[model samples]
Target: MILHAGVLGLLVGGTVIVALMLFGSLVGVRILRTWNPMSTSEEQLILERQTYLVSVLVAVALWIEIGSALLFIHTVDDLHELFVGAMCATGTLNANPVGWWVLAAKGAIVLLFPIWLAVNGLDQRSGSFPLVRLKYGLLLVLTPLAVADLSLQIAYFGGLQPDIITSCCGALFSESSDTVTGDLAAIPAVLAFPVFLAVSLLFLAAVGWARVSPRPISRIIAAVLSPVTLAVGVVAVISFVSVAYYELPTHHCPFDLFQSGSAFVGYPLMFSLVAAVVLAAMPGALLMVTQHPALRDVAAGSERRWLTGAAAAFTIFLVVAIWPLVFGNLAWESM
Candidate 1:
């Protein structure tokens, strides 16, 4: 399994990303120690050039990181057939539980990378490069995570064995099971559906308020609600939205959303949610830099765009999530 093309590709790509991150970290250290935007000395000149180079390198790596995250999911899902009783990516993950950690790490990297890029972008917009040190310090902080992502991927893929019989999603997602996922699965659609709808609407309203008013307090409210909405959205998917997708009241495996038979609707559904989360967080994230006069105008302009994007994303999420329930043959009484 480790020799699989997708597996090898991810490993190679991850290796390259880690190497770039390591190099960036070294540059980051130098930047932290000696960055002086106002100085016109040759050393400062060299540092300026290096900062641009490192930024581009890191940006490319982060973009790859996003692609790698999606590929990781596709690869794991593709590998499910090798394990007995395996039906989806969940089974591949069950084959080596560490794969779950790999998934999580990839998710974190994907979420953080865009935020970092946003910060770097805002800094570049300023003549002083005011965020140079902060960006590099963040780079240093992120290097370990990149290293851990690669390491965990190695551990996961290397540990997979054809002989390992994994439990299918049905076993884990069933209400009769004791796991947290089971608890989510157990949540009655009657209850879960309403909760999901309400939370999503509230999130939309908050984001709308921010977009219309463009106040710090409003943006903060939208930002704070964003993650909460994501959490509830996941739970809603597990609880009822997935059932609608599968069209079977008892079949609650969220991983099945990526399967071909479902037209891979999960990809867009998930992308919408993730995009919403990232965009929603940006206004508040910009808040951190807005305290500096140089960033205030930039942040102000960016916040409006962010809030608008976030509102659109959340709306798309709601529409996709409820599509099955509203149009499909699935029914609450089926449960």
Candidate 2:
């Protein structure tokens, strides 16, 4: 009975998440179209309607995929165990040509949505402000987080050894045993020190750059980047420590709180927290800068509004995309 309830919960939750992702994609497409520079008025109207129709289809398809994944998850029992089960299921499905075709089609839809947005949404030049430049800057902020995430993956794959020396030796350390627990405990301390130092230096440099500029806009840019740098730094420190030192209990799943191996909770928490903090800080910083002595002197009324609106829109998008993870109960554990 408990198992059935758990399965149902997963199905409902996963469906909701898929719905959100699809909705976000649709919103992103609309944002892109609104900012599109080259479309004729008639063309824009037609595309807008088409975008809505495609969004509805995407939403329905996402719900179906969620149902499929949930069914698969329930059959497997363990979330981590599902990877192997999925592979076995894939093998069985491969025996049926029709099943293979169906799976392939679903896979294509899942993969294509993001690709479509990246290629089409980014290629066109649009609004007055430099969308590409802002996008690139966002990428820069995101890169470190990506790298840190990759490092966690590597650590997990390598196995949970506490000492860097032993971890390098490729031994599958036990989470329950003293030797393994000690090793896991040491990981966070080892990983965090260097990351924190580097991030702090970067923040100092940004602050210095902002101080040198006499304009409020420059200060505002600095302000926006500063908190982001700090948040990322905090996440990196937490992840570095958590991945290096934590150990899992022998009887329970490795994902449980006591487990040294599961980064599932820590990773998403850090990612969402950092993203949220940076986004929350962006608008106020932009507003303050626009009203500053340097910007006010050089810009006309129209230009100021354009710059402000562009900055606000970009920040809002960032916030909306990551808002679920931060405020909603959809962290790595849920995934």
Which digits, one per residue and each the tens of the lDDT, describe model 2 over residues 1-335? Answer: 12344445544544454454445444545555464536568756665455445444444544554354334322322323323222222222322223334334433333333222222232232222224333333333323332332233223323322221211111222333355433443344335445555654554444444434444555565456646554554444323323322321121121231222343343243333333333323333444333434444333342333334433433443343334334544233312
Best by lDDT: 1
Lowest lDDT sum, 10 consecutive residues, model 2, at 162-171
Clashes of each: 0, 12
* Candidate 2 Cα deviation (angstroms), residue 258: 8.9
Estimate every model's Cα lDDT from 0 to 1.
0.87, 0.37
Deviation (Å) of 147 in candidate 2: 24
Worst 10 residues of 1 by lDDT: 282-291
Once fitted onto the true fold, the runs of candidate 2 whose alpha carbons sit more than 4 angstroms away are: 1-44, 52-194, 200-240, 243-268, 273-335
